[model samples]
Target: MALHSASVNSKLIFAPAGKESHGQAEQFTRGILTRSDLDQTSPIWQFHKWFAAAQRSELVAHPETCCLSTASLPSGRVSSRMVYLKELDAEGFVIYSNFGTSKKAQDLSTNPWASLTFWWEELERQIRVEGRASRLTREESQKYFDTRVRGSRIGAWSSRQSQVLKPIQGDAGDEEDDGRRVLDGWVKETEKRFEGEENIPVPDFWGGLRIIPESVEFWQGRQSRLHDRFIYEKKAPTEESVQEWTLERLSP
Candidate 1:
């Protein structure tokens, strides 16, 4: 089911056969972003500003979500999934997950570079981050882990992140093709293991991964498709020099 059309005045007016055109096309005149609007010192600071606006806007939901992408080695196959942004610090952005069996972990094992994309459509803004991913210290991970609800913590320990789930043979009728029982059984077992325990330890295979950005780009949509873009690139530091970032305007 492919609905296609050419853009007129930068509005994507979709035309599908035997149907009326979809919702009214909108021109992106929400805001005009400029270089001076960004923080001169750090991309992190600028990101915080935009992030705060997104959080406050009624039009945005789940503003902390972003697309995380990784590429497998040798084959160079790329994979992406939506993940919640768990924390941010002076160094970079952080998210937590099973770092053992997940495809992302496997990719990171071979290639450390990864990318994150945040698209706030209602605000007509996007941000791209490219960085090297490294595991957060166990102690640091525990700090975030302790904040999770009990069930999520149990889930982190119960299931292998990316493994295929196959229902046990002869355990149920043909209707159970999805193998959800296997997951339910694991969850029940995990629950019993920690029946009355007040505290749960973070699994060794699960924790936080922080992406130290080499480059961060901010984009804002405009009318006529002439978008605004700026990028902050990290610079290498010498023995006597501290780290620094250079900001440059990008052609949209």
Candidate 2:
């Protein structure tokens, strides 16, 4: 059974009684977004501009973090998770993950379409990217893999991501029993396997997935709930190597 909003609201309580509006929503005054503000040439150039601003802002932390959303085919069950944007080029945006067992990989196998959402609340801005994802070649993936720390490289080899973990059987009250130990043991084994080795090989199951965007949208918040939105959509299917984009404004 679902609870009504009134019932849910009645039971909610916070610190400092009578201070209902202490941290309430405020009118957005950061800046206005307009059609003229967007880059005429390419959305990637525009994204670079906003992203550089985010990187420069003192209030923004981990600007590369974004929500990656994927939907499984047939049933179309959607799932989303936070992932770091590792690399971006003229082609697309790249993120690394376990391609063998992770849920996103499973979804991508069945449905190549995916979307990424980046929200910077402090800046009152958001960006949405919808695209088709494909795995990067082993050589390309290896290049990025080589840049990761030793622990992370080992972790890539250790973890069978999205797989259910089982703790050793024990009495219900046994505090020592833990499912996480299974992963820790795998890590220890991987560590020993590469001991004294200067370079660890990138696991075949882990690599980068690049999202080649078909459309990208930029949003900026405004007062009175009226906001600004601009979207860049692929012009059309073409055999040409270089893709072109058509920009338009969306009603708030």
Candidate 3:
């Protein structure tokens, strides 16, 4: 007997044994959605308060950014990620990343405009920001890095982010070593290799970026999909006059 198969139009549905099926799967996810159902307040300050409270629990949250940042790599492709919001004040949202990192840094060099988004799953809240990025001084970066635990500081040195990793011969058991052990081992090894060095220096590649907001929008999700939005916009600065910010309510 001979093996046989049937085809529908030009596509084949069956294949020989051991052949694997190839296709893409649909993805579905849900969140409390905003719709045209609830009463929206004219004053946005009310929603802003709620949004700020939801973010207060964690400085580093996903779907959050000091602002939206887009960068074009050397390969001419754009990449984006949620960078940690390190500080926020009257000035704007503050964040830090390596100057050598491929995303926002390179783009900031040419174009400074950026945007950020914050979404709270539990409370059904979201905040969007548009801004310009400015590099923080080395002093500021060093100050923040110094405040970090010693292990974090060492990890900063060990991680060459956005770079490939190479497999090497070493005791795999070291993978389970604690931060203190790794730091101590690195220090001892450095001292031995460098003829008794006393301290390890901070790496030059690490630093921070500060995003100055030009506009900020806060969103609140309500029952039946009606959502609330409030936006703050700043006027451009002039030589004789300082920039000013105004708040407005937006239709959901």
Candidate 4:
């Protein structure tokens, strides 16, 4: 086997030996199972094994974090990037980014629909989720943000993300002086904003987006091009009741 690099949003492409076309190789590579191989099981148990394996590997490798993609209104092109997955639960996957951030925040405003994919090569598995996202409560965001290290909290306050960085040349002392000034300004502003509370409040623009998964599909690779796949679909409630899901197998 031979591997090569192709610049597609900073992602790598691996090809087998003697493969002539990258596109053909990519299509072949993505030929995993469809939604027809799963057996009837509880939603949690249907893909328990694969999910556990993904979690274990993610803990160590943190494969590509989480990618957030959104389509702008009318006919604008879509944009995506790698963001950290903060938490995952029965509710859905949770991720935090500044509300002032461009792609995510804007998309969430117009369209709350999103998708998440997790790929684990060691396990030959992939999990994809599609869902609607909503903002987490202030209490939830504060609880998580407060647990971060002091330096991280300070950094969050000291820097403006997604903004251009101006070049400034100076000696070590001058740099130190600049940093101190910025830090001091942040400290004073924060103190005044929070009324001198020792526990810093979570920034209003920083919070979490909880994706309520409407569908989750799990795929596993097998030899001879025969693969296995299962998809779980969340059932809508007719009345004011809890949501339920139905599992279905898809054709490979």
Q: Best by lDDT, which number?
A: 1
Alpha carbon lDDT of residue 35, candidate 4?
40
TM-scores for all candidates: the values are 0.88, 0.89, 0.62, 0.68
Q: Candidate 1 or 4, higher TM-score? A: 1
Clashing pairs in 3: 35-225, 67-115, 67-116, 68-115, 68-116, 96-208
Tens-digit lDDT track of model 3 for 87-128? 665566677676675556677776777767776665666778
Query: Residues 1-252, candidate 4, lDDT per residue (tens digit)?
Result: 336564446645445434653543222253455444453433445445555556676643765365777666655557677787787666777887777655667777777788777767666667777889889998999888888876566556554556544444466766434334544566666556655455877777777888788888887776654667678888876487766678766666
Q: Which run of 10 residues does model 2 get worst, by summed lDDT?
A: 13-22
Q: Show the colliding residue pairs in model 2.
A: none
- Model 3 Cα shift for residue 193 (angstroms): 8.5
Task: State which candidate, 3 or 4, has the greater lDDT.
Answer: 4
The runs of at least 3 residues in candidate 2 whose Cα sits more than 4 Å from the true structure, single-residue gaps closed, are: 1-24, 170-174, 237-241
**Alpha carbon deviation, residue 201, candidate 1 (Å):** 0.4
Clashing pairs in 4: 35-249, 35-250, 36-249, 36-250, 36-251
lDDT string, candidate 2, 137-220, tens digits = 999999999999988999999999999988876678878756988898899999999999868888889999999999999999
Worst 10 residues of 1 by lDDT: 11-20
